[model samples]
Target: MSKSVPHAPTSFRELEAPQRKAFFAAWLGYLLDGFDFILITLVLTEIANDFGLSKTRAATLVSAAFVSRWLGGLVLGAIGDRFGRKPAMILSIFAFSIGSALCGFAWGYWSLFAFRAIVGLGMAGEYGSSTTYVMESWPVHMRNRATGFLLSAFPIGTVIAALAYGVIVPNLGWRCLFYIGLVPIALTLYLRRSLPEAEEWQADVGNRRNVSTSSMLFASSRRLPNAVLAIGLATALVLIFSQHTAGYGWLLAAAAIAGFIVFAVQVAGRLVPVMLAVMATVFCAFLYSWPIQSLLPTYLKSELGYSAVQVSTALTWAGLGYAVGSCVAGIAGDALGTRRAYVVGLFLSLLFVFPAFALPAGNVVLLWALLFAMQFTSQGISGLLPKYIADHFPTRLRAAGLGFTYNVGALGGAMAPLAGTTIAGRVGNLGTALMILAGTLTVVVAAIIGFDLPARIGRAFKADDEKASSAMTERNTTRAM
Candidate 1:
């Protein structure tokens, strides 16, 4: 038996038709994921008015969706690992598409929540399915660029939602917005006909069949450090829960203690570089960026007295910035390294994001510029994930590993809307809450950099293609015998 690793395509045209179709399918699916979710944000006020709910209650809908994404990612990620990305992707699109349509008929808060949860579950798999499909299909050298293009969909869909809502909601109504989500069903059909599974994935499937879903990172003594790291992280989570449950303002205390605890655990645990890589991307990319996107519309409409159309305009501009920034970050990450690029972009975000929210919101140009820079910097840092995911995990467990990183991060993101609204409910201003959150997140990211976390993660990289090929060859030989 023999194994082979192919060279990455030098240009987009070099990719085969199925590979090209898979790329487009993944991008469109990713875009629609943003579209469906952001549509909720755009219509939050109308829904609140119809249902007689407070801002906090409306925000809870967003939280519910995020919480469910954890389960969706875990389940679908395993499916992707065990079966194929195309199937997982197809199912996920169906779930979200149906869920979005169901939302149009919802009469009350609970009903909407249930439907949104369905959408969340479906949306959750995109990170594992489409991302893994395209990333694995492309050559490793283009990893970050492909991810940038894919991730750029987040902002593009958001922008479309913003603009579409501004145009459609006034003319047709909020329910009409939900109907628009049904459009992604077209993508599912396209993917079914045209998409191709990654060769790398096909090669490794046999070897990955018996892999554990629960605590896969802890299956060996050599992997015990990852176990400790997981435990330490869990402990940190418990501490955060206790502090938050006790009261606000204890987060700093909890975070300080949790840091020390993680350090102690690392000393005992020898945490895997890949795990740290995941944490760095999670903290830097998702934690700060998501809340701004989810809750900013509320702030603009309620606090700043902007019309719905105006808010949509601002968001559309920002989303465009994020989309472009994703492309630029892809290049920068390769040059400066992902972590360093993240540190720089994050710092840039700290400069404008707060002002984008805190400043007087009447001037469209000023708001657009600030928001563009804010989203560009914040979302740009996210460019780190593609490269990291491609580099860190083996082919056998790639989807699960990617899903775990993304969904676990979404766990924190799920809390963002709730936290923002709760803080706004307390202090009477969303701006204050956003500033507090953004400032705190910036500090944490800076501190993480100061601790030299990126260097540790960087040292841990190994290319998986050859090993994956060998695994496939070994499996094929055994099966034939």
Candidate 2:
């Protein structure tokens, strides 16, 4: 006879040793991601000055890293799906850690840009692989909270970077700050020692092994059109940067985006609507966030005339808010559902942007408080994402779907720095530029999640759950026979 299923753990205290270990390992990976990625933001002004670059040029360096993130997500996410989460996580950590170290040795702007791109590849890969590993390890009932706690590691890393900047950059210079990014490499050892391949993924792989190669080939072919459309959009994005001054460039980018959306509707697949919703939601969310995350330090230092120490202090406050917000988001997500939590946080973020960006630049205390509030609302929504996105796909597609939707959406973030700087130059006010971009995008995200997405995604998730339950029953019955 088939054995009875065991009771699922309901709390952190209830999790077995391996489950808790997996969570911490993934959390550490996210922490290192935040540190290495945001380190450039903390020292953006110093890097620009050192390289004798203009605002636009400095922004390009940030964009360079972002442009490759989607590719990393696609490649490494596939690796996670096809091979195993443990190996994928190990590879991602080593890649970013080594890439971060190489930044310190860069000779000039292009060299630094290239190095950061390498960092981006690893950083993007880490999220999907690590998140899938952790989420699969935990009980389904606790996923929202567990994901929240895992993502909180990112902002904590931001806080650490801020503190490191204050301590290291002034004395040892910006290069030393980057050198510190290499520290996460040691985390790879902990990960390898502590974690195994996710059991869920292994089971899924075993079930799929007997599937025909022809069926796999057919599925791959079906996705080719979406891939082609994605590639086209990416190219148009590059043109936006490469041809920013050209009037037709804007028209071309707009046309490309419109074309992609239209194609999604015409595609006529069950996943089309889901992907469209996810793509739109993630794209807009990044648009809202990246202006602040990428450019706020420059705004504080260059525009407001704040010192590096003051900027670090401001970031610390924001980081703390993000951390608290993440935990609260997890709890709220569990109680309210991911959709409501996301919509509420996004709506609040839209309201908070005006005060955060438009208030008097002279009052440092007010600025800090507003920033904390803004990050709390805006970035806290991030805590909902790992659970929100992962629930949509099965174990087989989990890594690839998470990686694609999230990282491809990062294209919006990839554009934000350059776009924000360009607008700031045209508008003659950094705060106004930021407000316009952030406020507009927040509305887009809130509306998509609140109106267009929830019912459809909920139905899809429920169907998947019922299907899995049925399959389990059938398997157990066959074994008993």
For each candidate, what is the lDDT?
A: 0.71, 0.77
**Predicted model with the maximum TM-score:** 2
Span of 10 residues, lowest total lDDT, candidate 2 = 209-218
TM-score of each: 0.80, 0.85
Q: How does model 1 fare in lDDT?
A: 0.71
